[model samples]
Target: MYTTLLHQYQLTLSSRNALFDYCETVKPEDLLKPLATINNESMASLLLHVANCYVFWLANSVMQEKHAYFKGDEHLDLTAVRNVYGQVDLLMNEFLNHFKDSLDVPLLITRPDGSQLTRSPFEIFTHAITHEFHHKGQVVNMSRQLGYTPVDTDVVRE
Candidate 1:
């Protein structure tokens, strides 16, 4: 199960990279243009949100490590986004390796509202991936609305 889960994580990375590549096709100034349709979030903000989720779950919750993502990420370009992804990937790999033996062990994660929820590392990882996938759809929609059609990121046949 650990190995399979690890494969899934890697595949998710590939799926996400497809979107990041699409981001590169956007005009530099337009990256931060707020899409009035989709929650008013810019393209960069959505990507940053996805990256931050990985850090929050893998680094903060499970590994008890620190993460650094800035609120001014709308200024970040595709290259900077790639750099952030590199850091996040490193942290996630560490988290997976460290918690391989404790997939079912309940971990107490404190929410923003001060509530604590107990979940296993496996569950947390699954949640993080799904969260990103959900937002990826939004990113796609925003890009299309902006006239940039992104490549298919679905993992079904990729």
Candidate 2:
């Protein structure tokens, strides 16, 4: 079961990479284009937001480690986003290495609103992965609004 969960998480990561690759093809000037989203978050902000969610859940909340993921503005270019992605990727590896054996153990996970809930490591892992895919869809929509078409990043893609 743990291996299966890990596999699912890896699939999410793979798809995320594909999404980033597609985004990289976007023109540099388009990176900060304001999307029609409610909050007016640009493509770069959306990307950075997704990237920071990983660090927030895995490093800040789950592992209880002080890992920082973002080092640039929301209008950051794709290259800066890529740099932050590498940092968050390393933090995720550390998160998995530290908690892989504790999948079934209950840990206090915190929500974005500062509320806390107790959940197993596996559950939290699944949430984080799904959360990324959910936001990825939003990113794809935003990309379309910015005049770029993104390929499918679904886990089941052939």
Candidate 3:
């Protein structure tokens, strides 16, 4: 189970990098363009949300086992958004590396509604990666609608 979890984590990390690279290639101007039909958020907004989610989950949920994800207002700065993403990526990598030898240890996570559950650290790691992928799909679709070619972020190919 530990080996399988580690492999999943590695694959997820690769997939995340692929998605980030794809996002980075998008033009800065197009990132803020509004969608015509759907009231979808701008690419920059989505990216910012993703970064913020990562930080909140890592700091409060994963590391501290606290239920609440974030406690702040939305950020609208592109450079700050990028920096947040970079920092979360580095922190996630560091955490994974540190726990590589303790994959079997379970983590206790508390819910915002006051529920408690236990999961392996590997499972929490996988959840974080997959959560990002779920949101990255939205960004990819938004990128396509904004007249940009979205990079192929298929996990199997990466």
Candidate 4:
């Protein structure tokens, strides 16, 4: 379980990096192109949200044992959002290095509604990565709909 979870996290990181690279090649003006008529978030917004979610899960939830990261009025911008992704990625790598030998250590987590749950550090890591993948798929579809080339990020299909 530990090894499999670690591998998944690694793959998620690679996929995310690939997606970001592909997005970076896109014209800045193109990022704001309307992709959908209803419930549409720009490509930039989607990318920013993914990064924010990761940082929130890592800093507020996993590391500090606080509630979810965002409150009501958290100021978010593209540069800050991108920085969060890089920060969380580095933090996760450092964490895995330190805890690889003791992957069974239980992590105490506090839910949004003030509930408590216990899970292995591996499990929390797994959740974070999978969550990013889910959002990335949405961004990909939106990109295609907007006539942008979606990032080829599928681990198996790429």
Writing each residue's lDDT as its tens digit, candidate 3 over 60-156 gives 6667733333222344445556566667767676666766787568878776677888877677776777777887788789888877787778778
lDDT of model 1 at position 4: 84
Q: How do the candidates rank by TM-score, highest first?
A: 1, 2, 4, 3
Using lDDT, rank the candidates from best to worst.
Answer: 1, 2, 3, 4
Model 4 quality (TM-score): 0.72
Model 2, position 113, has a per-residue lDDT of 86
RMSD of each: 1.7, 2.3, 4.0, 3.8
lDDT of 2 by residue, 56-155 (tens): 8887888877766674464378777877877767776776677778888999877768899898877767777778788788878887887777888787
**Model 3 ranges off by over 4 Å:** 1-21, 34-39, 65-79, 156-158
lDDT of 1 at 2: 84
TM-score of each: 0.91, 0.86, 0.69, 0.72
Q: What is the lDDT of residue 10 in candidate 2?
A: 78
lDDT of each: 0.82, 0.76, 0.67, 0.67
Query: Which is the leading candidate under lDDT?
Result: 1
For lDDT, candidate 3 versus 4, the one ahead is: 3
lDDT of 1 by residue, 1-158 (tens): 78988899889988888878778788876778888897788878888888888888888766777676645544368788778888878887888888889898998888667788899999988998999899989988887888886788887645
Best TM-score among the predictions, by candidate number:
1
Write one digit per residue (lDDT tens) for candidate 4, span 1-158: 55675687778878877777777766666665546652666666666666666666665666763434432123243455466566667767765675677667887878668998887767767677777788788777776776777757977654
Query: Which residue pairs show backbone clashes in model 2?
Result: none
